[model samples]
Target chain A: MDRKNIKGFLEFVYDFYKSMKAHEITLVYEGEITHQITKAFTSLTESNMAKEEESNSVQKKVFHVMVECLQNISKHADSFGSDDFLFAGRGIFMVSRGDLEYHVTTGNVIENSKIEELSKILDHINSLDKEGLKQLYKTQMREGRLSEKGGAGLGFIDIARKTGRKLEYHFLPIDEDTHFFVLTSTISRNE
Target chain B: METIKIMGTDDTPTVILDAQNEIFEISGRSLPEDVTAFYDPILQWLDEYSSSPNPKTIFTFKLVYFNTASSKLLLDILMKLEQLHEAGNNVVVHWYYPEDDEDMQEAGEEYADIVDVPFEQIGYTLS
Candidate 1:
């Protein structure tokens, strides 16, 4: 491996290990990578059963959340771009399993101009609880700006409400015109 | 102007909305690759359906599962129905959840609180 690539890899591993101090099972997908996320999703879910069978509700919610988070990576992947600088937009999707909760995090490079809008949406969704989320979601649907692409921006809020957890996020500056968007959410199995 | 039908899958729901019949049904799970594309037609169909007065509009949403994006579209559908109801059309939303799934039941109630129409949450045992 080239020195630069090796350095980046080591740094990523170090950061991931530091962040997930207590997780036993950690799956990390980096760069322009692809996999059957569903298989990993199903296996991690099945591992939850030590011997006793768990409810289908738990399985469904976990699966739903996993797929939703992974789809963000697929949706934002910039493939076939001529600019090598745009190569960093490849993204990373990671899932970490702890004894009591599951942590799902995804990071993708996005346009710097979109950072404000993304932050606003995250802040708005985080500001609401289940009831408030539903209300705000409805209101947005009624009056929010719909892109010609047809997105009204309620995906993050739904994640928060459905998982019954806070939607955590961070924006790490990558360059002049782009930033790495990292979103993390937790689902408690004990609940 | 026409009905939109999307077959169900293990990961996604079956979107069955017929503008002509004024019967909208979303069943099964929802985790489509692209949320916007998957839901646009359904939203468009509902929008067109709302323009003309349909005597009875029944929205049956029995989603075993749905991701965050699908939740957004679900709200969109409900709001469109609310607009229709406000205009004095007959609109009712039947929200079905698996028995013992309090999360789904709570989700329905939350939607009920937002929209004007009555949302009846029905539960059926999987067994």
Candidate 2:
């Protein structure tokens, strides 16, 4: 069937993950992406046993960041229904690993028209190192609007800064109306 | 002028805004299901506090985390305090944040810029 490539892709992914030594594993989720937002976060927390040993300070910060990031996806993603405000998706979320870090990846469906804006924001945030992110975070937090449901578009930037990792992204065109946006970030516990 | 004390929840912060005492404190996390309900009374109390100026008003915000809506309401609250200060009332914001947390500290600094009151950033030793 013409689905061979998709099947192959799945096989490769399976083999790749089977080779890794992940401390925690989460059930793969499919279908409407919004419901998976919380699942993605839970997966991260579940997999990272080190998370428990983490200092209360780190735990609090990570918890805060997790909530903010999940909300961000919900705010930006395309969805249908009154409960849409409470959930997000049309995306995929998974956690994988490297040698010394855990990776969190979330993919969501977005309007193709907004790709340029999203790219610009990602590039701008990526360009800023720690200090620059701090300055930007402060600037946005102070002057940013509060009445809105989303942060001053600073949530993702804040995430990149806090994680101390470059945000990795991919845009796969799903169709004329929508595009799949992927965001991959790593949180490093080893310094 | 009323006293409202809502203890901090897993999702929201403790809100202690006493109109009579002129002590406004919001501490802990803030990501309430319905932010309007949680903030409505606090906003109303601030209105009263502004009307009959207290000799000294201390606004303390020690939030571990707050979402966007809470952030806006925070600005509204700060602006009210600024008006109080402008009206020749003694208003001071003693903002405290965890020492290593640049986000919270910067948030305090941002508020300091917009409001005319004296804003101090106090870093507590991590406990």
Candidate 3:
């Protein structure tokens, strides 16, 4: 612990605290995503929202959106170029509260080959209106087959339908085989 | 057949499906990490019950919150009742929701629209 390095670390910590406070972020975690982990995050967020005096319906919406976002990472973690220990089984999850809505943001790695297909799914969901999303949701549930991992590919549509807001996302290319996918789902707080 | 009564946790719902005592209900939150595995028994129970169901089966769903995965499982359960109804059984579903919760109410309506089972959406206060 050199004096100069210790001083820099404290400054970094202080800066992070300030940024988090400014954003009104309720929870943040960067690690592996699992069922147990999702349960913990959602439970903690539920408590936090309760403290904020949110209505029961808004609390339900936020809780639902958070579960979907976290579960997506655990269920859909890409296996490309993940041999690197740092990249394998790692993800970033955060929840922030604003005046009009609560935001659930997640970041994870994805195979390059899956980018186009994934993009199309998100785009298609975002392109539709309320009724359209409802139709798609029913159709997907009735006809869609569960993946090898048991996901019926209904998370996004359900989130979109519940929140009544467009999903915001983008992929940052890390190399040729993998990209960092970041998604943010907003739940309006009018309740 | 033995009844299925599993206590609900923060993630899983409390399920009560006892045929002998005239009680059949599923309530509370549901978001198990493994939906297929957790719901397999319930589905199986419904399957077996369909074969030798009570003359008049009145199942109830009092789910407070459930994920999309569980949504599919709910449809499966409702379809079982629908099949029972089609096979000369009087099956009615009472989808219960908190009085002020539109999402839960609408959820019941959606299921009612898709399935042929007689549905009665009942709104009650959360005591």
Better of 1 and 2 by lDDT: 1
Instruction: Name the 10 consecutive residues with the lowest summed lDDT in model 1 chain A.
Output: A77-86
Which is the winner by TM-score between candidate 1 and candidate 2? 2
Each prediction's DockQ?
A: 0.35, 0.35, 0.65
lDDT for each candidate structure? 0.72, 0.70, 0.87
The C-alpha stretches of model 2 lying farther than 4 A from their native spots are: A1-52, A56-61, A80-90, A96-99, A146-151, B34-37, B99-103, B125-127
**Collision pairs in model 1:** B12-B29
TM-score of candidate 3's A chain against the true A chain: 0.93
Give the candidate order by descending lDDT: 3, 1, 2
Off by over 4 Å in 1: A1-22, A32-57, A75-85, A111-134, A146-150, A173-179, B1-6, B16-24, B35-55, B83-88
Q: Number of backbone collisions per candidate, in order?
A: 1, 4, 0
Candidate topping lDDT: 3
- Alpha-carbon deviation at B77 in model 2, angstroms: 2.3
For residue A164, model 3's alpha carbon misses the true position, in angstroms, by: 1.1
- Looking at candidate 3 chain A, the ten consecutive residues that score lowest on lDDT are A79-88
Q: Which 10 consecutive residues of model 2 chain A have the lowest summed lDDT?
A: A21-30
**Model 3 per-residue lDDT tens digits across residues A77-172:** 765443554445568999999899888999999989899999999999999999898888888877776676668778999899889889999999
Expressed as tens digits, the lDDT of each residue in B23-108 for candidate 1 is 68999987565566777777777777778856888889998777655666678788888999999998889999989888788779
